[model samples]
Target: MQFDAILKQKDEIIQQLQSQINPLKNLVEQLLAEVKLLREQNAALLELIKEKDKRIQKLELVEHQYHQLTKLVYGRSSEKTSTALPGQLSLGIDAELVEACNINDGQKIESYTKIKSEKKKHPGRNEIPAHLERKYIDIHPENLPADARTLRYNRNRTIGI
Candidate 1:
């Protein structure tokens, strides 16, 4: 009777161990499958990095070609040459207009010019008007009727020092 009881206890313990072993094996298999999936993702990421490198190289080559073309088309010299002379307009000057004109003491001409230049460098979203486009040439003394007469008289009166 004592030998039979000992044999029964040993058999019950073996059965319990077998039941736990199967679940542990299943957990190890799941972990192995996850590791394989992670390896595949790492391989795909490496491939993507290589493709991005190739694209960057191609863009750099394109930029180099564009610079070469620009240099070839535009000469290195700063001076611009034209075959024909620019058209000139002759206006009769009146000395009386210069005698009557009054000069402004508070004119901020320099600041106005700087502001306009800055605007050109960083233009607004709206398109520029034709009047503003012509402002640079328009402000010249030669373009103003009264100022042109005064400048012409002064230019002719001044002797070479």
Candidate 2:
């Protein structure tokens, strides 16, 4: 009879332990699912970041090309030539010229030049109108003789409104 009671007690303890372990197992499964979802999100976000980086690089290249095209269209057109003149040192072109002449059996070289034209004048400011009325006032020296007054006469002209 004592052994039967002990067996009954052992079974009750096992049932209690199983009941506690059930909730813990469920919690562990939930945590594992959360961790898996987080890992998937991290991977997706990393791929998006990589795609954005590629797009930014492409946009930067396009913007650089656009700026280059704009500068070619609107920038200064005149450029100094690097062509070797009469007294300048002939770099590598002389060898190429000699080779070409030998291959072509002494072909004569001809030079061409553009014709010069006169540049148009750019007037800076508007000219004053000649039809405007002018008023002149003359001042004589205050303490001068008649002959000295003529020498000290001052004249000023003001355009009438």
Candidate 3:
């Protein structure tokens, strides 16, 4: 009879544990479904962000091309040459203006030119300095009548004299 009572208490403990396990299992399934929905929403937001970035890049490229075209149309370049001479107005070569104004044959157009003469100036030789004076030394040979006579004078003796 005690063995039978012990078996009945064990059966009650197992039933309580199974009742708690059923509620925990339901909570786990609900959490898993919520996680799946959030992942789908995150992927859609990432795709939207990528599309916006592509549109911003395209607009920036178009803006850069517009600025380049504006600079090309308005910037100064060496290709444009002036056609007006001196004493005449600096009018650019516009087809409409050139066609409207024609040179009259009876109009008196007078121009004068002056001749220029260049004078050449020669720089003369430099003069000697006032502080420096010239000293003339008379070198008379002692043996004057030899066919080819050579003289060896000491520099110290000449400088002292």
Best by lDDT: 3
Q: Could you tell me the TM-score of candidate 2?
A: 0.40
RMSD of 2: 23.2
Residues 33-102 of candidate 1: C-alpha lDDT, one tens digit per residue:
9999999999999999988976786677789767766765684643223222367544544444543456
Clashes in predicted model 2: 0
**Candidate 3's error at 81, in angstroms?**
15
lDDT of 3: 0.74
User: Which ten-residue region of model 1 has the weakest summed lDDT?
Assistant: 133-142
* Local distance difference test, candidate 1: 0.67
Model 2, span 1-161: residue lDDT tens: 99999999999999999999989999999999999999999999999998897678667778976876676667665421333457887655443354346555657889899898988899889877899876656554477665542433334333332
The Cα local distance difference test for each model comes to 0.67, 0.73, 0.74
Tell me how far the alpha carbon of residue 154 in candidate 3 is from the true structure, in angstroms, after superposition: 46
Which candidate number has the best TM-score? 3
TM-score of each: 0.39, 0.40, 0.41
Candidate that beats the other on TM-score, 2 or 3, i.e. the better one = 3
Candidate rank order under TM-score: 3, 2, 1
